[model samples]
Target: MATLLLRFLLKAALAFLAVSVLWVGVYRFVPPPVTFTMLGDVIGGHGITKDWMSLSEMDPDMARAAIAGEDSRFCAHHGFDFRAIGNAALRNAKGGRIRGGSTISQQTAKNAFLFQGGGYVRKAFEAYFTVLIEALWPKRRIMEVYLNIAETGIGTYGANAGSIRYFHHDASRLSASEAGRIAAVLPLPKKRAAISPTGFVRRHGNTLSRRVATVRDQGLDACLR
Candidate 1:
């Protein structure tokens, strides 16, 4: 009975490997149709709203804002940022709110291929997918996919959708402040609105907006460029 169970588990593992490879390969060329997170929102009566925008189509400041706010070392790291992970771990150990060190590539992997939330099992799978994506897709492609698929607002997905919902404009020509505001809502989209942020959200958005110029000047988004 143990041998039979082992065989079944082995088969399942191999099947998952094959399917995941295929999924990543396909998405390297095609925008992902949907994600589990989007599906869950739809199931919960919050219909998914998304507008696919390529990296070239959106304002460059938007990408810069993401790099400045979420992952300053996005271009420097492969799939993980060990330094950021260490910093977050140390901070969490100090007994405040838990923090994550997920790089944009890792977040892109999760946003594109997996569900939100956490667990060791989910994290292991996320890591595997992150490696696959870094190996299969270019850095620019990864950024493009992340910006297009990331949850930007409640029941809304992607920068374009969020821009339209909040500012009544498309993402093609976002001002630095506008882009930063949208990026700021990324960490907790459901609870925050970019339209009229206050407190930490407003302050963080302002900080990100200022950092956009630094990102551009220092070529922090060099990979995307």
Candidate 2:
């Protein structure tokens, strides 16, 4: 009985490892066609549309804008940014849920591995997969996955799809301002339209634009370096 139990455990461990390896390999090579998103059901089951854009193919401005808008400490962190997490915790303790400290790596992991929800189990899974992705994939790959899978519009729209739907252009052709605007809508894509400029959207877009310039002036290569 002991030997049988040990064999079962070993097989389970091997199966888990194999699944992990397969997930990383598939994400690295093949672009996913569809992604699950919270907005899908909210918007009448419209699937989240995604377009695969490689890091090499995207403009530096787009990358900088993304980091500036989403996670400024993205280049420095591993899977999670403890500072942001602490800040978020403090806010929550004070009876506020002001900010989300999800890093690019964490977001990538969530988008790729789990369903969206606000629950402890989901969050735990997010953290676990975030660590795995950070260990298995490069920083560039993480950002690429995030940009592709992140919910950028209300219905059946992702980054590339949102870009085309709003600006009438591809994500690769997006200017800094356009990219900033797109990133700005990320926090409230379902409730807001990317093309329509609300006060909050405009403010966020302007803030992102300034940060993007700062990122560029400091040199994007410097962050990676």
TM-score of candidate 2 on Cα atoms, chains taken together: 0.86
The lDDT of model 1 is 0.93
Instruction: Give the number of the best model, judged by TM-score.
Output: 1
lDDT of each: 0.93, 0.76
Give the 10-residue window scoring lowest on summed lDDT in candidate 2: 216-225
lDDT of 2 by residue, 188-221 (tens): 7776666867788888887887788888776643
* TM-score of candidate 1 on Cα atoms, chains taken together: 0.96
Q: lDDT for model 2, on a 0 to 1 scale? A: 0.76
Model 1, range 188-208, lDDT digits (tens) per residue? 899999998998789999999
- Candidate 2: how many backbone clashes? 0
In order of listing, the candidates' clash counts read 0, 0
TM-score of each: 0.96, 0.86
